[model samples]
Structure formats: structure tokens, C-alpha cells
Target: MTTLFHNLAAWVVAWAHTPYASVALALLAFAESSFFPIPPDVLLISLALIQPRHSFAYAIVCTAFSVLGGMVGYAIGRYGGRPLLERFMSSAKIHAVESYYRRYDVWAVGLAGFTPIPYKVFTISAGTFLLDFKRFILASFVGRGGRFFLVAALFYFFGEPIADFVNKSLNMLSVAFAALLVGGFALIHRLSKRYGQGSARPHSERIREP
Candidate 1:
């Protein structure tokens, strides 16, 4: 599994040298938000290193499609994920996440989107927990945009040194960031089960329980 991801990462990185890298970056951003593991940062960083002048454009493409993909992940959780989680996961535990979501919906999604905490899980779980869709989308835009554009900015100003620094330390930094949050993704392990109950409905129609 480790080797497979390494190969996949290499393959994604290779696309940066191609004329199709822009397309690959867009596709990669969209995929990573939902199903793919290796984040678009790999491609975004590589592309920026190749042509720092175009870095901002690549960031725009990355942020936009990633949010779109997050919406799809939300649907997957809303319609499918909650049912699967219920078979083995405890209601008491999932309800803990429900309460968490009810209280910190945007912060949860936003932080997940920015950090290495697997935003896909939170995106799907947001639907499973019946979080407000508009807020989810807004937070996705902010967090994903912030992450990708920060990469763009680094290369734009810092030039070559940032290329090596960001490439090597991005994961370490993300881990450090995650460490600051008490429980972080651990708090989300018990994340999704509510939609199986009375929570499944149009995102716009859903309301918090009193």
C-alpha cells in the first residue's frame, strides 16, 4: 500500500512537466477532495516550480474544483455513508460528532479542508451529520482556497527555496497544525450516523434538533 501510494505520487508529479499539467492539476484537485488520497498540492507545487508566474492561475483551478468535489463527497455521505457507518459504529459515539457538528459546523469543515486531516471524510460526514450546505460550501472555499493560494504565494514571493521547503515540509507542517487541535481527526472518527435517522432531507430543509 505504501509503495502504491508512492508510485501514484510519482505519477501525479510527472504530470507537472507535461503540457497537460494544467488539466491534470484541475482534475487532481477535484479528485483529491473526494476519493483520491494524494492531495492536489503535489501537482500544484510541482506546477508552480515549473512556472512560478502561472502559480496563481493554478491555485484558482485547484480551489474551485476541489470545492465542487467536496459537494459530491457530501452527497455520498448524505445518501450512502451514514448507513454504512451505522452497522459497526456506535450511536453514542456518532452522536458525539453530531453534537460537535451542530456546534462547530463551519470550523470543523474549514479546518479539515485546510489541514492534512482528510477533508473527504468531513465533507461526506457533513452531509451525514446534516450540516448546513451553504456553510459547508463557504467553509470549503475558504479553507481550500487558503491552502492552495498560500502555496501559490510562497512561490510567487519566496521563489526557489520555498519549492524545496514546501515540498518537503508540507506534511510535517500539516501534522504540526493538526497537533494543535485537541483530538483533531480522532474527534471525527465517530463522525457520521445521524442521517440514517430523521436527519435525511434536502440540505436546505434540514434544521438542528433542540
Candidate 2:
């Protein structure tokens, strides 16, 4: 598994230097926001590190495609995608998604977008719960943009030094970043629970009117 991951990472790094790199990054970003398991950041970081001159452009492309993918997930949820849930997800997964959406509203989507959480889950849940489209787009833009841009800037400005640091501390950094992402979700979850006491609605009950 470790060897496979290392080889995959090496391939991604090499791909970043090719013209196809941008295309792959865009697709990865899109999938990351939908149902894909891998985060786009890995590609974004690799591309930015390889070509610092176009870092910001890559960030923008990543952000735009990711938001578009999020909208697709949301649409699925909003328009009878709930039935498909049983096809793709387990009952336990569906229940957890419903619980989160009920408690946090659209902010849950934003939290997932920015953090290490699987963003597709929140996107689907948001649509399932009939969240406001305008608010959903706004949250997706802010959260996804903030994360990608921050990463792009870091790699753009301090490529080698940061690369060395990451190489030396990859394991620690991964754990720390994962913890931070979880902490962000935990904080939002607490706040949402507090706020939801008054008027929270479950996913199954949040159908939009025609």
C-alpha cells in the first residue's frame, strides 16, 4: 500500500509538468467535490510546486471546477437523488448525513468543502435537505477557494523549503492536518447543534416546492 501510494504520488508529480497536468487537476477537483475519494489538493500542490508561475491560475481553475461539481451533487440531492442513496450509500451513512444536515444547515457544506471531510457527502446532503442554492454556492466558493489558494500560495512562494519540510514531516503533517479538519467539523457541529434547537429540519422532510 505504501509503495503504491509513493508511486502514485511520483506519477502525479511527473504529470504536473505535462500539458495534461492542468486537465487532470481540473477533473480531480471536480471529482473531489462530487463522489471521488481523493482530494484535489494533492494534484494542486504538485502542480503549483512544479510551475510556480501559474500557481494562482491553477488555484482558480481548481476552485471553479470544484464548485461546479458541488452544484451537481447538490442538484442530485434536490431532485429525487435521495432514492439513489440506497444504491450508493448504506443506511447508516444516510442517517449520519441527515443528522449533519439537520443540525448545521448549509454551513455544514462549507465546513466539508474547506476541511478534509469528504465534500461529496455534504454536497449531496445539502441538496437532499433542500438548502438554499444561493447560500450553497456562496459557502462552496469561500471554503474551497480559501483552502486551494492557501495551499497554492504556500507552495508557490516557498517551494523547495516547504517541500523539504513536508518530506521530513509528511506523516506528522498529515496527522495534524487531518486533526485540524476534524476539529473544524467538531466546532461547527457544536455550534449547529446549539442553533438547531429552535427550527432544525430533517433531510427527508426538507422537500422543495415545485
Candidate 3:
């Protein structure tokens, strides 16, 4: 897995150095926010490191296209619903995400946008639940912009060193992200359990009802 990501990251860096890098980056960001698993951070970092002066521009493109792609995911969930979600993700995964929507709502969208827990899930869930459009857009913008621009800033200033660090720590980052995902699920479960217990009636009350 490490080798695969290293190779992929290398490919992204090399590709970002080409003349058509901007278009490619835009497309990549768009796809990632909708269906693609690979984040645009790879290309954003590479392009920024290579052309530090253009880092902000790279971030802008990433943020814009990513949000646009999120809209596509929203449309899919809104129009296609669970059938479409099942085509990509499992029913259980979708259910967990739905619970998250019930618990966190719009903030969940922002968290997914900036985190490695798969923004696509939240984007689709937003539409699935028919969340307020304006709030969703606002959350996406803030989250995506903050994340992409932070990457750009790091690359723009630290340059090659930061890129090298990210490349080397890719595996660690994945593990950390996974840990976070598990933690989130555990928290949700705990909350649900508590809520269930609190909402339950006493045994005497149940007998009286009968």
C-alpha cells in the first residue's frame, strides 16, 4: 500500500509539472469531491512546490472545482437516492453517514470537507437528507478552502522539504485518518446508546400501558 501511494504521489508530482497541469488539477479536484478517492492535495502540493508564486492560484482552483464536484455528488444523492449510493458505498456505510447527518447536520459536511474521512460521503448525504442548499455550499466553501489553502501555504513557504515530509508520511497520515474515522463512529454509537437509554420508559410504566 505504501509503495503504491508513493508511486502515485510521484506520478502526480511529475504530471503537475506539465503545461496542462492547471486543467488536470481542476479536473482532479472536481472528481475527488464527487467520486474519486485520491485527494487533490497531491497535485496542489506538487504544483505549489514547483511554482511557489502560483500556490494561491492552485488553491483557488482546487477549492472551486472541489465544491463544484460536491454539487454533482449532491445531485446524485438527491435524484438517485440510496440506489445510487449503494452503487459506490455499502448500505451500512450509508446508514452510519445518515446517523452522522442526524447528529451533526451541516457541521458534519464541513468536517468531511476538511478531513480525510471522505468528503464524497457527506456531499452525497447532504443531498440524501435534502439539507439546506445555501448552508451546504457555505460549509463546503469554508472547509475546502481552508484545507487546500493551508496545503498551498505550507508548500509555498517550506517548498521541497514539506513535500518530502508529506510523501514520506503518507502511510502515517492514512493510519491517522483511519483512527479518526473509527473514533467518530465510536462517539456516534455512544451517543446513540445514551439517547436510547434516556428515551426508554421504565418497566412499571410499560406494564401500566398494557
Candidate 4:
């Protein structure tokens, strides 16, 4: 697994110099949403560091393709069902994902998207569990967009001086960013409750675990 990850990282980095770098990024974003193991950030971060001015553009491409790819993942779950999901992920893992859906509903997608969690798991599980399609898309859009844009913004604004820091601390940066997002969400939920705006989510949204 480590060897394959290193090889894939190298392959993704090599594309940064080519004319098709953005295309590769888009493809990586797409594939990773479903089947690919490596995240598009490997390429996004590489390309952005080399060409900071185009960071947001790269982020837009990554987000768009990732959401499109997520739809395909949803289709996989909708059509392929539990049997197909079992082939890619273990039953225990699948059940855990389903449990998240039961608890957080569509927001589970947002959490998975913004964090280091394997998005493919939530994407496929969203389908197998028959989550609302529109909500799934919305959550994916926000979560994926937030993450890619946040990564891009750093290199885009800070330039070369921060390159080493970003490279060394990217994982920690992502974790901190995700924690902030989660905190913001919790705060909003709390505010809504305090203001009496916290209406109960529809029961259907909380699909029971299979």
C-alpha cells in the first residue's frame, strides 16, 4: 500500500509540468471521489505552489469534477447496492458509514468531504442508503469546495515564503481547518436551537442503517 501510494504521488506530481496538468487534476478529483486511492490535493498542492496565481482556478476545476464524480459514486450505490459496496469496503466499515448517515444524515457527506475521511465511503454509502440526491449534491459541493479552496488560498496568498511550512504542515493544516468548520457547524446548530429555529430534520433524511 505504501509503495503504491508513493508511486501514485510521484505520478501525480509529474503531471504538474505538463499542458494537461489541470486535466489531470480534474481526473484525479473525479476518480478519487469513487475509485482512485490518491486524493487530488497531491496534484492541487503541487500545481498551486508552482503557480500560485492560478490556485483558485485549479480549485474550481477540482471541486467541479469531484462533485460530478460523486454523482457517479451515488449511482454506483443506487444501482450496485450493498453487494458492490462490499467489494470495495469491508462490511464493518460500510456499517459504520451507514451509522453516520443515520446520525447526521446528509451532513455526513459534508464532514467526510472536508476531512481526511475517505469520501468514496460516504459517497457510495449515501447511495446504498438512498440519501436524498439533491441534499447529497449540495453537501458534496459545499464540503469539497471549502476544502480545495482553503488549500488553494494558502499558496495563492502567501507565495513562496510559506511553501516549506505548507508542505511540512499540510496535514495538520487540513485537520485544523476541518476542526474549525466542525466548530462553526456546531455553533450554528446551537444558535439555531437557542433562537428556536432548530426545526427537526425530516426522518427520511436519517435513513436507517441496513
Candidate 5:
């Protein structure tokens, strides 16, 4: 699996050298947000490195398509629910996301989108939970846009050094981001337990319980 991802990343990097990289980047971004395993960052960074002047354009394409793909995930969750997600994801992963959705709602989706945490989980969970469509779109735009643009900006300004460093340390960076996600979720859960107890329970639970 590791070797396969590395090969795919290499292929994406080579593709970035071509003129069609722009379209490829958009499509990868779209797919990543919905069901693709590889994130668009691999391609986005490679393309940005090759054409620093077009870094921002690449970021824009990534952000726009990512948001669009998120909507597809959301639609699947809304209309198809767990059966659809189960086709691609494990039951445990889906359950974890459901728990998070019950606790954090929009913030969960936004943070997942912004971080290395798989944003598809939250996008689909938001739909399954019937979260407000407008709120979901807003969160997706803000989080996905910030993350992709940040990567583009770093490549634009720091150039090859950052690119080389990121390429070499990508695994370490993902681990660090994952750590942060775990910590953030722990804190959110603790705070909700302590301070949100007084609030009324979620509607679905309330209906189901009584």
C-alpha cells in the first residue's frame, strides 16, 4: 500500500509538469474530497513548484473542486446514508464520524476539512445528520480553501526548499497533524461534557429516547 501511494504520488508529480496539470489538479481535488484516497496536495505542490507564478491559480482550482466534491459526499450521505458510505468505508470509521458529528457538528466538519484528518468522513456525516446545507458549504469553503492556499503560498514564497522538505517529511507531517486532531477532539469532548451538559440534547436523540 505504501509503495502504491508513492508511485501514485510520483506519477502525479510527473503529470504536474505537463500543461494539463491544471485540469488534473482540479479533478484530483474533487475526487479526494469525495472518495479518493490520495489528497490533491501532492499534485498541487508539484504544480506550484514548477510554476510559482501560477501557485495561487492552482490553489483556487483545488479549493473550488474540493468544495464541489464535498457536496457530492454530502449528497450521498443525505440520500443514501450509511449504506452508501459502507461501500467505501469501514463500519468503525463511519461510527466514529457519527459520534463526532453528534458532538461538534459544523466545527467537526470545518476542522476535518482544514486538517489532515479525512474530510470525507465529516462531509458525509454532515449529510447523514441532516446538518444545514448552507452551514456545511460555508465550512467546507473556509477549511478546504485555507488548507490548499496555505500549501500554495508556502511553495510560492519558500520555493524549492519547502517543497523538498515537505516531500521528504510528508509522513512525519501527517503524523503530527493526526496528533493535533486527536488532541483537539479530546479537548472538544471534555469541554462539551463539562459545559454543554445543561443544553438540551440533540433532536434525534431526544426523539428516540422519549
Candidate 6:
């Protein structure tokens, strides 16, 4: 898998200079938001690094396609994914996902869109939970757009230095970002549990002995 990824990354890097770069970026962004294991950020950053002038445009394209792909993932979950989830994912994983979604809903989707949290899981969960499409699109747009644009903006302003820093420290950054993502989801889960359950609970002053 590592070898395949390295080769694929090399291919994408080579294609960055081609006119097909934009098309490739869109496809990659789309796939990444759905079931593809690789993140589109690699292609976006490589292209931006090679052609700094068009970085923001590249970011916009990446964001748009990514959100669209997320919608597709949502549809999958909403339409015919629940049974598959039960068949494929572990009980523990399902409980974690349900708890998080039951707690956060759209905010959970947004954070997953931006962070390093295997976005495909949240995309599918959003559908299973019957979340609103409009709100899903809006949250995905904000989160994914902010993430790609932030990277593009940094490359636009800092250029090679930023690239060098990322190349050298990517593993560390990935770990840090994952930690933050998990913590954010946990907080959202807590808040959702508190409010959702509180409203559902009845006020009682009398206790009967069993």
C-alpha cells in the first residue's frame, strides 16, 4: 500500500504541471471525501507548490469537489448504508459513531471535513442519522473550504519555506491534527448528550420504593 501510494503521489506530482492538473485535482478531491484512502491535500499542495500563482483557484476547486463528493457519501448512507454498516463495522465503532453523531450532528460533520478524521465515516454516518442535506452541504463547504484555503493561503504567502516545513514535519502535524480532531468530536459528543438527553428527560419530584 505504501509503495502504491508513493507511486501515485509521484504520478500526481508529475501531472501537476500538465493542463489536466485541474481535472485531476477535482477527481482526487471528490474521491477523498468519499471512499478513497488518500487525502486530496497531497495533490492540492503539490500543485500549489509548483504554480503558486494559481494556488487559491486550486483550493477553490478542491473544496467544491470535495463537498460534492461528501454529498454523494451522505446519499449512500441515507439511502442504503445502514445494513452495510452493521455488516462491516465493529459494534464498538458503530457505537462511537452513533454517540458522536447523536451528540454533534452537523458540527461533527464539519470538523471531520476539515480535520484528519477519515471523513468517509462521518459522511456515511450523516446519511444514516438522516441529517438535512442543506445543512450538511453548508457545513462541509465551510469546513473543507477553510482547510484547503488555509493551506493555499500559506503556500501563496510563504512559498517554498512552508512547503519545506510541511515536507519535513508532516508526520508530526498529522498526529497533532488527529489529536485535535478526536478531542473536538469528544467535546461535541458531550454537549449533545447533555442537551439532547436533558430535553428528553422528565422533571420528577416523587420517588416510589420498589
How many pairs collide in each candidate, listed in order? 0, 0, 0, 0, 0, 0
lDDT string, candidate 5, 92-149, tens digits: 9888877877876776677687777877777877888899999999988877877777
For TM-score, candidate 1 versus 5, the one ahead is 5
Total clashing pairs in model 2: 0
Q: What TM-score, to 2 decimals, does candidate 5 have? A: 0.77
Error of 4 at 194 (Å): 2.7
Give TM-scores for every candidate, taking all chains together and pairing residue i with residue i: 0.76, 0.71, 0.74, 0.88, 0.77, 0.77
Model 4, residue 185: C-alpha shift (Å): 2.3
* Best candidate, lDDT: 4
Ranking 1 against 3 by lDDT, winner? 3
Q: Which stretches in model 2 have alpha-carbon errors above 4 Å? A: 1-14, 164-210
Candidate 6 clash figure, as a count: 0
Query: lDDT score of model 3?
Result: 0.81
Q: Candidate 6 lDDT (Cα, whole model)?
A: 0.81
lDDT of each: 0.81, 0.78, 0.81, 0.89, 0.81, 0.81
Candidate 4: which stretches are off by over 4 Å?
Answer: 197-210
Error of 3 at 134 (Å): 0.9
How many angstroms is residue 108 displaced in model 1 relative to the true structure, after the best TM-score fit? Answer: 0.6
Ranking by TM-score: 4, 6, 5, 1, 3, 2
Q: List the residue pairs that clash in candidate 4.
A: none
> What lDDT score is found at residue 115 in candidate 6?
72
Q: Which has the higher lDDT value, candidate number 4 or candidate number 5?
A: 4
Superior by lDDT: candidate 3 or candidate 6: 3
Give the number of the best model, judged by TM-score. 4
**Worst window of 10 by summed lDDT in candidate 1:** 189-198
